[model samples]
Target: MQTAVGVFGGEGYKDGIEVPPLMVANAGQSDRPEISSLNCPPFVAVELCREHLGVHPCDRRRSINEYRSLFPAIDFSLIENDDDVLWKADTREKNEEVAARGLKFLSWLWTRKEKEIAIVTHSGFLYHTLSAFGSDCHPSVKDEICKHFANCELRSVVIIDRSMMGSDPATTNYPGKIPSGLDLPSDVADEKLPDEGKVN
Candidate 1:
């Protein structure tokens, strides 16, 4: 069965890592399914999707400006901030707020029967969304999921149904339930992550 997998870009990717050629080749499949993102680095993911999957994103944004020569056939959206709020905000609640916007997009995508779908965004946003895929999740479990993803890493799941997703999607930052050693949203607010590295 064809699987839709999200590919994180290697912008600030640690060790100068790049998306695997095999993954890029897989994304270049003949089906040409729609790719999606939160309007920033996901455009980098879009480029990956087109370069690897042979599909174009459903909505386009200008984040892929650097790839004009490589992905000449791709048409980018002129819409400003179409994929906003995923990581731009400072507070956990604000972050969750934008993530909910992303969740809404995914829940809508789940309605389609297209065997696979891919989303590309920064590690932090990706971690939050992945954790939200489970029910009654423990903070440790969420922490574990958040810690595992690295730049250009591709993680896939068989979402028979979005069992973990709610009618109204929200982020699981647990701002009010902070663990003892974890950094608070404010503490990490100004932290600038390289597009190519693991968030942790």
Candidate 2:
């Protein structure tokens, strides 16, 4: 089976306010304007998988629950776990760790031979994780990634069969694709006070 992955950026945030309506608009669902974050809700993610990935209904619910449980608190925050050895590492080390983790995840998923696997994560996660695939890009591009991915934008990476390791034709890399989508609301965008000052 062939496997493909997609990475999407979170919603926008100015200061600490969240633009509720914009967030809904970006998800291609304007009727539900109550969404407060860019990370797709568990139900939505599961629906997407069912509709697009053709996962079984039971399997989709289980996957959604697993994902949601993995990150119980989904508000904006660093991805590193408290026990992660690279938590205190320097910038280079941190980036390397992120990339390693991303590759590892991909490798595991590829083993399943699923047709498509989508990862909805923050911009930093995507940038650092996928840095290994990017060549000769500007240094600033990495830094700007944190800002540019401020909105709920969808980006996809297609790894054709040829690109897989140990395949008949060893294709090392494929062009990373970033798709366009509407803007989402951010907690920071709709807030009047600074994020730090906001009461949880």
How does each model score on TM-score? Answer: 0.38, 0.35
Q: Looking at candidate 1, what is the lDDT of residue 54? A: 11
Worst 10-residue lDDT window, candidate 1:
47-56
After superposition, which runs of candidate 1 have C-alpha atoms over 4 Å from their true positions?
1-70, 75-93, 111-113, 137-144, 162-200
Put down candidate 2 lDDT per residue, 1-200, tens digits, no spaces. 00111122344445766433212322322233223344433212212111111122322123323333333323323222332233222233345555676666556556654576566654555666556552433344334333435545666666554444344443233233322331222343345334533578
lDDT of 1 at 125: 55
lDDT of each: 0.40, 0.38
**Cand. 1 TM to true fold:** 0.38
